[model samples]
Target: MLFYRAALPLSRKTLTFVAGIIRRHRASIGSCWRKLNPGQQALLVLAHLRKGETLAELAAGFGVGVTTAWRYVNETVALLAARAPKLRRAVRDAKKAGYAYVVVDGTLIPIDRVAADRPFYSGKHKKHGMNLQVIASPGGDILWVSGALPGSVHDKKAEWIWGVLAELEAAGLVTLADKGYLGSTYAKIPYRGKNKPESQKQANKAHAKLRAPAERANAQLKNWRILRKLRCCPWRAGQLAKAIHVLQIREA
Candidate 1:
Protein backbone atom coordinates (compact mmCIF):
# COMPACT_ATOMS: atom_id res chain seq x y z
CA MET A 1 0.00 0.00 0.00
CA LEU A 2 1.16 3.57 -0.70
CA PHE A 3 1.53 5.25 2.65
CA TYR A 4 2.34 8.82 3.57
CA ARG A 5 3.06 10.14 7.05
CA ALA A 6 0.79 13.11 6.55
CA ALA A 7 -2.64 12.34 5.10
CA LEU A 8 -4.01 14.22 2.10
CA PRO A 9 -7.32 16.04 2.35
CA LEU A 10 -10.23 15.83 -0.05
CA SER A 11 -11.20 19.10 -1.73
CA ARG A 12 -14.32 21.03 -0.78
CA LYS A 13 -15.76 20.44 -4.24
CA THR A 14 -15.36 16.71 -3.84
CA LEU A 15 -17.04 16.83 -0.43
CA THR A 16 -19.96 18.71 -1.92
CA PHE A 17 -20.30 16.19 -4.72
CA VAL A 18 -20.19 13.29 -2.32
CA ALA A 19 -22.67 14.95 -0.03
CA GLY A 20 -25.16 15.44 -2.84
CA ILE A 21 -24.91 11.80 -3.88
CA ILE A 22 -25.31 10.61 -0.31
CA ARG A 23 -28.34 12.86 0.19
CA ARG A 24 -30.10 11.54 -2.90
CA HIS A 25 -29.30 7.93 -2.12
CA ARG A 26 -30.47 8.33 1.46
CA ALA A 27 -33.78 9.60 0.13
CA SER A 28 -34.12 6.67 -2.27
CA ILE A 29 -32.86 3.94 0.07
CA GLY A 30 -32.55 5.18 3.60
CA SER A 31 -29.75 3.92 5.80
CA CYS A 32 -30.42 3.10 9.45
CA TRP A 33 -29.83 5.93 11.89
CA ARG A 34 -26.23 5.85 13.07
CA LYS A 35 -23.55 7.89 14.83
CA LEU A 36 -22.05 9.10 11.53
CA ASN A 37 -24.20 11.37 9.42
CA PRO A 38 -24.14 11.51 5.63
CA GLY A 39 -21.26 13.99 5.65
CA GLN A 40 -19.16 11.85 8.01
CA GLN A 41 -19.91 8.75 5.97
CA ALA A 42 -18.76 10.53 2.81
CA LEU A 43 -15.63 11.73 4.58
CA LEU A 44 -14.86 8.26 5.92
CA VAL A 45 -15.03 6.82 2.42
CA LEU A 46 -12.90 9.61 0.96
CA ALA A 47 -10.27 9.21 3.67
CA HIS A 48 -9.89 5.56 2.72
CA LEU A 49 -9.82 6.27 -1.01
CA ARG A 50 -7.80 9.49 -1.06
CA LYS A 51 -5.64 9.26 2.04
CA GLY A 52 -4.94 5.51 1.88
CA GLU A 53 -6.09 5.03 5.47
CA THR A 54 -6.35 1.41 6.53
CA LEU A 55 -9.72 -0.14 7.40
CA ALA A 56 -8.54 -0.84 10.95
CA GLU A 57 -7.37 2.73 11.40
CA LEU A 58 -10.58 4.12 10.00
CA ALA A 59 -12.68 1.85 12.12
CA ALA A 60 -10.84 2.82 15.29
CA GLY A 61 -10.81 6.53 14.42
CA PHE A 62 -14.56 6.58 13.71
CA GLY A 63 -15.42 4.39 16.71
CA VAL A 64 -17.24 1.88 14.50
CA GLY A 65 -16.85 -1.83 13.90
CA VAL A 66 -14.45 -2.81 11.12
CA THR A 67 -17.29 -4.39 9.16
CA THR A 68 -19.37 -1.22 9.43
CA ALA A 69 -16.44 0.88 8.17
CA TRP A 70 -15.95 -1.46 5.24
CA ARG A 71 -19.64 -1.31 4.40
CA TYR A 72 -19.66 2.51 4.31
CA VAL A 73 -16.63 2.65 2.01
CA ASN A 74 -17.91 0.08 -0.46
CA GLU A 75 -21.44 1.49 -0.55
CA THR A 76 -20.19 5.03 -1.26
CA VAL A 77 -17.82 3.76 -3.93
CA ALA A 78 -20.72 2.09 -5.72
CA LEU A 79 -22.80 5.28 -5.59
CA LEU A 80 -20.06 7.48 -7.03
CA ALA A 81 -19.23 4.95 -9.77
CA ALA A 82 -22.85 4.94 -10.86
CA ARG A 83 -22.50 8.64 -11.77
CA ALA A 84 -19.57 8.19 -14.15
CA PRO A 85 -20.31 8.96 -17.81
CA LYS A 86 -20.08 6.33 -20.56
CA LEU A 87 -17.47 6.61 -23.32
CA ARG A 88 -19.90 7.58 -26.09
CA ARG A 89 -21.45 10.36 -24.00
CA ALA A 90 -18.09 11.81 -23.01
CA VAL A 91 -16.86 11.77 -26.63
CA ARG A 92 -20.04 13.42 -27.85
CA ASP A 93 -19.51 16.22 -25.32
CA ALA A 94 -15.91 16.63 -26.49
CA LYS A 95 -17.08 16.86 -30.09
CA LYS A 96 -19.67 19.44 -29.15
CA ALA A 97 -16.93 21.43 -27.43
CA GLY A 98 -15.04 21.54 -30.76
CA TYR A 99 -12.09 19.48 -29.65
CA ALA A 100 -9.93 18.26 -32.50
CA TYR A 101 -8.80 15.04 -30.83
CA VAL A 102 -8.89 13.02 -27.63
CA VAL A 103 -5.91 11.21 -26.16
CA VAL A 104 -5.90 7.57 -24.98
CA ASP A 105 -3.60 5.95 -22.44
CA GLY A 106 -3.36 3.06 -19.96
CA THR A 107 -2.15 2.86 -16.36
CA LEU A 108 -1.06 0.03 -14.07
CA ILE A 109 -2.48 0.24 -10.57
CA PRO A 110 -0.32 -1.84 -8.23
CA ILE A 111 -2.07 -4.31 -5.95
CA ASP A 112 -1.14 -6.69 -3.18
CA ARG A 113 0.53 -9.86 -4.43
CA VAL A 114 -1.84 -12.69 -5.23
CA ALA A 115 -0.50 -16.22 -4.87
CA ALA A 116 -2.76 -18.45 -6.93
CA ASP A 117 -3.66 -16.53 -10.11
CA ARG A 118 -0.88 -15.13 -12.30
CA PRO A 119 -3.20 -13.12 -14.53
CA PHE A 120 -2.66 -9.90 -12.54
CA TYR A 121 1.12 -9.95 -12.99
CA SER A 122 2.48 -7.25 -15.29
CA GLY A 123 5.76 -8.25 -16.94
CA LYS A 124 6.43 -4.62 -17.81
CA HIS A 125 6.03 -3.33 -14.24
CA LYS A 126 7.20 -6.55 -12.58
CA LYS A 127 4.25 -6.40 -10.19
CA HIS A 128 0.75 -7.65 -9.61
CA GLY A 129 -1.68 -4.97 -10.78
CA MET A 130 -4.68 -4.05 -12.88
CA ASN A 131 -4.67 -2.16 -16.19
CA LEU A 132 -7.04 0.79 -16.54
CA GLN A 133 -7.62 2.67 -19.78
CA VAL A 134 -8.18 6.44 -19.75
CA ILE A 135 -9.37 8.83 -22.44
CA ALA A 136 -8.83 12.53 -21.88
CA SER A 137 -9.51 15.83 -23.57
CA PRO A 138 -6.69 17.90 -25.09
CA GLY A 139 -6.89 20.26 -22.13
CA GLY A 140 -6.36 17.46 -19.62
CA ASP A 141 -9.97 16.74 -18.67
CA ILE A 142 -10.65 13.03 -18.28
CA LEU A 143 -13.43 11.89 -20.64
CA TRP A 144 -13.86 8.23 -19.84
CA VAL A 145 -12.24 5.35 -17.97
CA SER A 146 -12.53 1.70 -18.96
CA GLY A 147 -13.22 -1.10 -16.51
CA ALA A 148 -10.23 -2.83 -14.95
CA LEU A 149 -8.48 -5.57 -16.93
CA PRO A 150 -5.66 -7.90 -16.04
CA GLY A 151 -2.28 -6.17 -16.05
CA SER A 152 -0.89 -8.83 -18.40
CA VAL A 153 -3.19 -7.48 -21.10
CA HIS A 154 -1.69 -5.01 -23.58
CA ASP A 155 -3.12 -1.52 -23.91
CA LYS A 156 -4.33 -2.08 -27.46
CA LYS A 157 -6.08 -5.30 -26.53
CA ALA A 158 -7.71 -3.59 -23.55
CA GLU A 159 -8.96 -0.82 -25.83
CA TRP A 160 -10.35 -3.27 -28.35
CA ILE A 161 -11.86 -5.51 -25.70
CA TRP A 162 -13.63 -2.53 -24.15
CA GLY A 163 -14.84 -1.38 -27.59
CA VAL A 164 -13.12 1.99 -27.04
CA LEU A 165 -11.31 2.09 -30.37
CA ALA A 166 -14.40 0.96 -32.25
CA GLU A 167 -16.53 3.53 -30.47
CA LEU A 168 -14.08 6.33 -31.27
CA GLU A 169 -14.04 5.27 -34.92
CA ALA A 170 -17.81 5.06 -35.08
CA ALA A 171 -18.13 8.50 -33.50
CA GLY A 172 -15.78 9.92 -36.16
CA LEU A 173 -13.50 11.40 -33.52
CA VAL A 174 -9.77 11.66 -34.10
CA THR A 175 -7.63 9.99 -31.42
CA LEU A 176 -4.03 10.65 -30.42
CA ALA A 177 -2.12 7.72 -28.97
CA ASP A 178 1.37 6.41 -28.32
CA LYS A 179 3.19 3.70 -30.27
CA GLY A 180 1.45 0.93 -28.36
CA TYR A 181 -1.61 1.71 -30.44
CA LEU A 182 0.30 2.13 -33.71
CA GLY A 183 -2.05 0.10 -35.90
CA SER A 184 -5.30 1.34 -34.37
CA THR A 185 -7.58 3.08 -36.86
CA TYR A 186 -8.49 6.79 -36.48
CA ALA A 187 -5.62 7.27 -34.03
CA LYS A 188 -2.68 9.54 -34.78
CA ILE A 189 0.30 7.55 -33.50
CA PRO A 190 3.87 8.80 -33.45
CA TYR A 191 6.12 7.78 -36.36
CA ARG A 192 8.02 4.59 -35.55
CA GLY A 193 9.78 3.46 -38.73
CA LYS A 194 13.55 3.93 -38.92
CA ASN A 195 15.21 6.34 -41.40
CA LYS A 196 12.30 8.75 -41.24
CA PRO A 197 12.52 12.14 -42.85
CA GLU A 198 13.06 15.35 -40.83
CA SER A 199 9.36 16.17 -41.35
CA GLN A 200 8.33 12.90 -39.74
CA LYS A 201 10.74 13.51 -36.84
CA GLN A 202 9.20 16.93 -36.28
CA ALA A 203 5.73 15.39 -36.43
CA ASN A 204 6.74 12.86 -33.80
CA LYS A 205 7.99 15.64 -31.51
CA ALA A 206 4.71 17.52 -31.99
CA HIS A 207 2.82 14.34 -31.24
CA ALA A 208 4.67 13.91 -27.95
CA LYS A 209 3.83 17.43 -26.88
CA LEU A 210 0.15 16.90 -27.72
CA ARG A 211 0.05 13.60 -25.85
CA ALA A 212 1.22 15.04 -22.52
CA PRO A 213 -2.30 15.71 -21.30
CA ALA A 214 -3.19 12.03 -21.30
CA GLU A 215 -0.17 11.32 -19.14
CA ARG A 216 -1.15 14.13 -16.79
CA ALA A 217 -4.65 12.72 -16.60
CA ASN A 218 -3.21 9.36 -15.62
CA ALA A 219 -1.08 10.98 -12.92
CA GLN A 220 -4.09 12.81 -11.51
CA LEU A 221 -5.99 9.55 -11.06
CA LYS A 222 -3.10 7.84 -9.32
CA ASN A 223 -2.64 10.77 -6.95
CA TRP A 224 -5.48 9.21 -5.02
CA ARG A 225 -3.22 6.93 -2.96
CA ILE A 226 -5.70 4.06 -2.68
CA LEU A 227 -4.93 3.60 -6.37
CA ARG A 228 -1.21 4.04 -5.76
CA LYS A 229 -1.11 0.41 -4.61
CA LEU A 230 -4.35 -1.38 -3.86
CA ARG A 231 -4.27 -3.63 -0.80
CA CYS A 232 -7.84 -4.83 -1.23
CA CYS A 233 -9.31 -7.49 -3.49
CA PRO A 234 -8.43 -7.06 -7.18
CA TRP A 235 -12.13 -7.38 -8.09
CA ARG A 236 -12.82 -4.07 -6.29
CA ALA A 237 -10.25 -2.02 -8.23
CA GLY A 238 -12.56 -1.13 -11.12
CA GLN A 239 -15.19 0.26 -8.78
CA LEU A 240 -12.60 2.37 -6.97
CA ALA A 241 -11.24 3.71 -10.26
CA LYS A 242 -14.71 4.68 -11.45
CA ALA A 243 -15.50 6.38 -8.14
CA ILE A 244 -12.29 8.40 -8.27
CA HIS A 245 -12.91 9.35 -11.90
CA VAL A 246 -16.29 10.79 -11.03
CA LEU A 247 -14.85 12.81 -8.16
CA GLN A 248 -12.16 14.15 -10.48
CA ILE A 249 -14.72 15.28 -13.07
CA ARG A 250 -16.75 16.93 -10.37
CA GLU A 251 -13.67 18.71 -9.06
CA ALA A 252 -12.80 19.88 -12.57
Candidate 2:
Protein backbone atom coordinates (compact mmCIF):
# COMPACT_ATOMS: atom_id res chain seq x y z
CA MET A 1 0.00 0.00 0.00
CA LEU A 2 1.10 3.54 -0.68
CA PHE A 3 0.39 6.52 1.57
CA TYR A 4 0.67 10.23 0.94
CA ARG A 5 -0.78 13.51 2.13
CA ALA A 6 -2.85 16.05 0.22
CA ALA A 7 -4.69 19.18 1.19
CA LEU A 8 -8.41 19.97 0.96
CA PRO A 9 -8.95 23.64 1.83
CA LEU A 10 -12.40 23.27 3.30
CA SER A 11 -13.37 24.41 6.78
CA ARG A 12 -14.33 22.09 9.64
CA LYS A 13 -17.78 23.62 9.55
CA THR A 14 -18.19 22.28 6.04
CA LEU A 15 -17.26 18.80 7.18
CA THR A 16 -19.60 18.92 10.18
CA PHE A 17 -22.45 20.27 8.08
CA VAL A 18 -22.09 17.50 5.51
CA ALA A 19 -21.74 14.94 8.24
CA GLY A 20 -25.04 16.00 9.76
CA ILE A 21 -26.76 15.50 6.42
CA ILE A 22 -25.30 12.00 6.11
CA ARG A 23 -26.10 11.17 9.71
CA ARG A 24 -29.77 11.90 9.25
CA HIS A 25 -29.77 10.17 5.92
CA ARG A 26 -28.35 7.01 7.43
CA ALA A 27 -30.91 6.99 10.21
CA SER A 28 -33.70 7.51 7.71
CA ILE A 29 -32.43 4.67 5.60
CA GLY A 30 -31.96 2.43 8.64
CA SER A 31 -28.34 1.85 7.74
CA CYS A 32 -27.33 -0.31 10.70
CA TRP A 33 -23.61 -0.47 10.21
CA ARG A 34 -20.89 0.88 7.93
CA LYS A 35 -17.16 0.72 7.53
CA LEU A 36 -16.91 4.49 8.02
CA ASN A 37 -18.92 6.82 10.24
CA PRO A 38 -20.85 9.84 8.97
CA GLY A 39 -17.96 12.23 9.56
CA GLN A 40 -15.48 10.01 7.78
CA GLN A 41 -17.86 9.53 4.91
CA ALA A 42 -18.43 13.26 4.69
CA LEU A 43 -14.73 13.92 4.65
CA LEU A 44 -14.25 11.37 1.87
CA VAL A 45 -16.93 12.98 -0.26
CA LEU A 46 -15.54 16.44 0.40
CA ALA A 47 -12.06 15.34 -0.57
CA HIS A 48 -13.32 13.92 -3.83
CA LEU A 49 -15.29 17.06 -4.63
CA ARG A 50 -12.88 19.76 -3.38
CA LYS A 51 -9.59 18.08 -4.15
CA GLY A 52 -10.72 16.09 -7.19
CA GLU A 53 -9.22 12.99 -5.65
CA THR A 54 -9.91 9.85 -7.61
CA LEU A 55 -11.92 6.98 -6.16
CA ALA A 56 -8.89 4.68 -6.26
CA GLU A 57 -6.75 7.00 -4.17
CA LEU A 58 -9.56 7.65 -1.72
CA ALA A 59 -10.26 3.95 -1.34
CA ALA A 60 -6.59 3.22 -0.70
CA GLY A 61 -6.21 6.04 1.78
CA PHE A 62 -9.42 5.23 3.62
CA GLY A 63 -8.90 1.46 3.49
CA VAL A 64 -12.15 0.80 1.74
CA GLY A 65 -12.99 -0.95 -1.49
CA VAL A 66 -13.28 1.24 -4.57
CA THR A 67 -16.96 0.39 -4.97
CA THR A 68 -17.69 1.51 -1.41
CA ALA A 69 -15.94 4.80 -1.99
CA TRP A 70 -17.88 5.30 -5.22
CA ARG A 71 -21.13 4.55 -3.41
CA TYR A 72 -20.34 7.07 -0.68
CA VAL A 73 -19.61 9.84 -3.14
CA ASN A 74 -22.73 9.19 -5.19
CA GLU A 75 -25.00 8.96 -2.17
CA THR A 76 -23.73 12.16 -0.59
CA VAL A 77 -23.88 14.04 -3.87
CA ALA A 78 -27.46 12.93 -4.46
CA LEU A 79 -28.46 13.95 -0.97
CA LEU A 80 -26.95 17.40 -1.38
CA ALA A 81 -28.34 17.85 -4.88
CA ALA A 82 -31.84 17.11 -3.67
CA ARG A 83 -31.57 20.05 -1.28
CA ALA A 84 -30.75 22.56 -4.04
CA PRO A 85 -33.41 25.13 -4.74
CA LYS A 86 -35.82 24.88 -7.64
CA LEU A 87 -36.36 27.68 -10.17
CA ARG A 88 -39.42 29.04 -8.39
CA ARG A 89 -37.79 28.96 -4.98
CA ALA A 90 -34.66 30.58 -6.36
CA VAL A 91 -36.58 33.52 -7.81
CA ARG A 92 -38.48 33.91 -4.57
CA ASP A 93 -35.11 34.13 -2.84
CA ALA A 94 -34.13 36.89 -5.25
CA LYS A 95 -37.34 38.68 -4.39
CA LYS A 96 -36.61 38.41 -0.68
CA ALA A 97 -33.11 39.65 -1.32
CA GLY A 98 -34.72 42.78 -2.83
CA TYR A 99 -33.14 42.24 -6.20
CA ALA A 100 -34.84 44.00 -9.08
CA TYR A 101 -32.78 42.09 -11.58
CA VAL A 102 -30.49 39.07 -11.69
CA VAL A 103 -27.62 38.10 -13.94
CA VAL A 104 -28.02 35.03 -16.16
CA ASP A 105 -25.12 33.03 -17.52
CA GLY A 106 -24.36 29.57 -18.88
CA THR A 107 -21.25 27.40 -18.70
CA LEU A 108 -19.95 24.09 -19.94
CA ILE A 109 -18.76 21.35 -17.56
CA PRO A 110 -16.15 19.45 -19.52
CA ILE A 111 -16.11 15.66 -19.63
CA ASP A 112 -13.32 13.33 -20.57
CA ARG A 113 -15.41 11.64 -23.28
CA VAL A 114 -18.94 10.50 -23.84
CA ALA A 115 -21.03 7.78 -25.42
CA ALA A 116 -22.08 10.10 -28.22
CA ASP A 117 -20.01 12.65 -30.08
CA ARG A 118 -22.12 15.33 -31.72
CA PRO A 119 -24.67 15.51 -28.91
CA PHE A 120 -22.05 16.35 -26.31
CA TYR A 121 -19.99 18.69 -28.47
CA SER A 122 -20.41 22.41 -27.80
CA GLY A 123 -19.88 24.30 -31.03
CA LYS A 124 -19.44 27.54 -29.15
CA HIS A 125 -16.78 26.15 -26.83
CA LYS A 126 -15.49 23.59 -29.36
CA LYS A 127 -15.47 20.93 -26.67
CA HIS A 128 -17.50 18.09 -25.18
CA GLY A 129 -19.34 19.09 -22.02
CA MET A 130 -22.66 19.65 -20.28
CA ASN A 131 -24.46 23.00 -20.20
CA LEU A 132 -25.54 24.52 -16.88
CA GLN A 133 -27.39 27.80 -16.64
CA VAL A 134 -26.61 29.96 -13.65
CA ILE A 135 -28.49 32.86 -12.07
CA ALA A 136 -26.58 35.33 -9.95
CA SER A 137 -27.29 38.47 -7.97
CA PRO A 138 -25.93 41.80 -9.20
CA GLY A 139 -23.14 41.30 -6.70
CA GLY A 140 -22.05 38.02 -8.39
CA ASP A 141 -23.46 35.69 -5.75
CA ILE A 142 -24.87 32.48 -7.20
CA LEU A 143 -28.55 31.99 -6.53
CA TRP A 144 -29.43 29.03 -8.72
CA VAL A 145 -28.08 26.48 -11.17
CA SER A 146 -30.39 24.82 -13.67
CA GLY A 147 -30.36 21.18 -14.62
CA ALA A 148 -27.75 20.00 -17.12
CA LEU A 149 -28.55 19.90 -20.78
CA PRO A 150 -26.64 18.63 -23.75
CA GLY A 151 -23.72 20.86 -24.69
CA SER A 152 -25.34 21.34 -28.10
CA VAL A 153 -28.11 23.36 -26.43
CA HIS A 154 -27.74 27.08 -26.98
CA ASP A 155 -27.59 29.30 -23.92
CA LYS A 156 -30.73 31.02 -25.15
CA LYS A 157 -32.51 27.72 -25.55
CA ALA A 158 -31.19 26.31 -22.28
CA GLU A 159 -32.46 29.27 -20.29
CA TRP A 160 -35.71 29.02 -22.17
CA ILE A 161 -35.99 25.34 -21.33
CA TRP A 162 -35.54 26.24 -17.68
CA GLY A 163 -38.18 28.97 -18.20
CA VAL A 164 -36.07 31.28 -16.06
CA LEU A 165 -37.10 34.39 -17.94
CA ALA A 166 -40.77 33.69 -17.45
CA GLU A 167 -40.26 32.82 -13.80
CA LEU A 168 -38.24 35.94 -13.12
CA GLU A 169 -40.72 38.09 -15.00
CA ALA A 170 -43.58 36.60 -13.05
CA ALA A 171 -41.70 37.34 -9.86
CA GLY A 172 -41.40 40.98 -11.04
CA LEU A 173 -37.70 40.52 -11.60
CA VAL A 174 -35.58 41.44 -14.61
CA THR A 175 -32.71 39.55 -16.24
CA LEU A 176 -29.30 40.77 -17.38
CA ALA A 177 -27.56 38.51 -19.82
CA ASP A 178 -25.25 38.47 -22.87
CA LYS A 179 -25.88 38.41 -26.63
CA GLY A 180 -26.96 34.80 -26.52
CA TYR A 181 -30.19 35.88 -24.83
CA LEU A 182 -30.84 38.81 -27.16
CA GLY A 183 -34.17 37.68 -28.51
CA SER A 184 -35.82 37.45 -25.09
CA THR A 185 -37.88 40.20 -23.50
CA TYR A 186 -36.21 40.22 -20.10
CA ALA A 187 -32.65 39.35 -21.08
CA LYS A 188 -30.90 42.67 -21.52
CA ILE A 189 -28.06 42.14 -23.96
CA PRO A 190 -25.64 44.12 -26.05
CA TYR A 191 -26.40 45.71 -29.41
CA ARG A 192 -26.12 43.67 -32.55
CA GLY A 193 -24.89 44.09 -36.17
CA LYS A 194 -22.20 46.78 -36.24
CA ASN A 195 -22.16 50.43 -37.26
CA LYS A 196 -24.45 51.36 -34.40
CA PRO A 197 -24.94 54.86 -33.02
CA GLU A 198 -22.69 56.03 -30.18
CA SER A 199 -25.63 55.83 -27.80
CA GLN A 200 -26.22 52.20 -28.68
CA LYS A 201 -22.49 51.44 -28.39
CA GLN A 202 -22.45 53.14 -25.01
CA ALA A 203 -25.45 51.10 -23.93
CA ASN A 204 -23.70 47.93 -25.04
CA LYS A 205 -20.63 48.89 -23.02
CA ALA A 206 -22.78 49.39 -19.96
CA HIS A 207 -24.48 46.06 -20.55
CA ALA A 208 -21.11 44.33 -20.69
CA LYS A 209 -20.05 46.04 -17.53
CA LEU A 210 -23.19 44.89 -15.73
CA ARG A 211 -22.79 41.35 -16.98
CA ALA A 212 -19.07 41.08 -16.15
CA PRO A 213 -19.50 40.82 -12.40
CA ALA A 214 -21.91 37.91 -12.69
CA GLU A 215 -19.13 35.89 -14.31
CA ARG A 216 -17.81 35.30 -10.81
CA ALA A 217 -20.67 32.89 -10.17
CA ASN A 218 -19.13 30.61 -12.74
CA ALA A 219 -15.76 30.91 -11.03
CA GLN A 220 -17.34 30.13 -7.67
CA LEU A 221 -18.59 26.84 -9.07
CA LYS A 222 -15.56 25.75 -11.10
CA ASN A 223 -13.29 26.55 -8.18
CA TRP A 224 -14.52 23.34 -6.55
CA ARG A 225 -12.15 21.46 -8.91
CA ILE A 226 -14.56 18.56 -9.51
CA LEU A 227 -16.57 20.76 -11.85
CA ARG A 228 -13.51 21.81 -13.84
CA LYS A 229 -13.97 18.51 -15.69
CA LEU A 230 -16.19 15.64 -14.65
CA ARG A 231 -14.62 12.21 -14.81
CA CYS A 232 -17.95 10.57 -14.01
CA CYS A 233 -20.97 9.91 -16.16
CA PRO A 234 -22.13 12.93 -18.13
CA TRP A 235 -25.64 12.19 -16.93
CA ARG A 236 -24.46 12.79 -13.38
CA ALA A 237 -23.11 16.23 -14.20
CA GLY A 238 -26.35 17.98 -13.27
CA GLN A 239 -26.57 16.13 -9.96
CA LEU A 240 -23.03 17.09 -9.06
CA ALA A 241 -23.70 20.68 -10.07
CA LYS A 242 -26.81 20.85 -7.93
CA ALA A 243 -24.93 19.20 -5.10
CA ILE A 244 -22.23 21.82 -5.32
CA HIS A 245 -24.88 24.52 -5.46
CA VAL A 246 -26.38 23.30 -2.20
CA LEU A 247 -23.00 23.08 -0.49
CA GLN A 248 -21.97 26.53 -1.69
CA ILE A 249 -25.19 28.05 -0.44
CA ARG A 250 -25.04 26.38 2.97
CA GLU A 251 -21.32 27.03 3.46
CA ALA A 252 -21.85 30.70 2.70
Clash tally, candidates in order: 0, 0
The C-alpha RMSD in Å for every predicted model, in order, reads 2.9, 1.3
Model 2: lDDT equals: 0.90
Which residue ranges in model 1 land beyond 4 Å of their true spot? 1-8, 114-116
TM-scores for every predicted model: 0.92, 0.96
Quote the lDDT for 27 in model 1: 81
Residue-level lDDT for 114 in candidate 1:
69
Candidate topping lDDT: 2
lDDT of 2 by residue, 1-252 (tens): 769887788888889999999999999989999999999999999999987889999999998999999999999999999999999999998999998679999999998885567898999999999999999998888899998998999999999899989998898877898887878977778889879999999998888888888789999899888999988888888899899888887778
User: How many clashes would you count in candidate 2?
Assistant: 0
lDDT by candidate, in order shown: 0.85, 0.90
TM-score for candidate 2, residues paired by index: 0.96
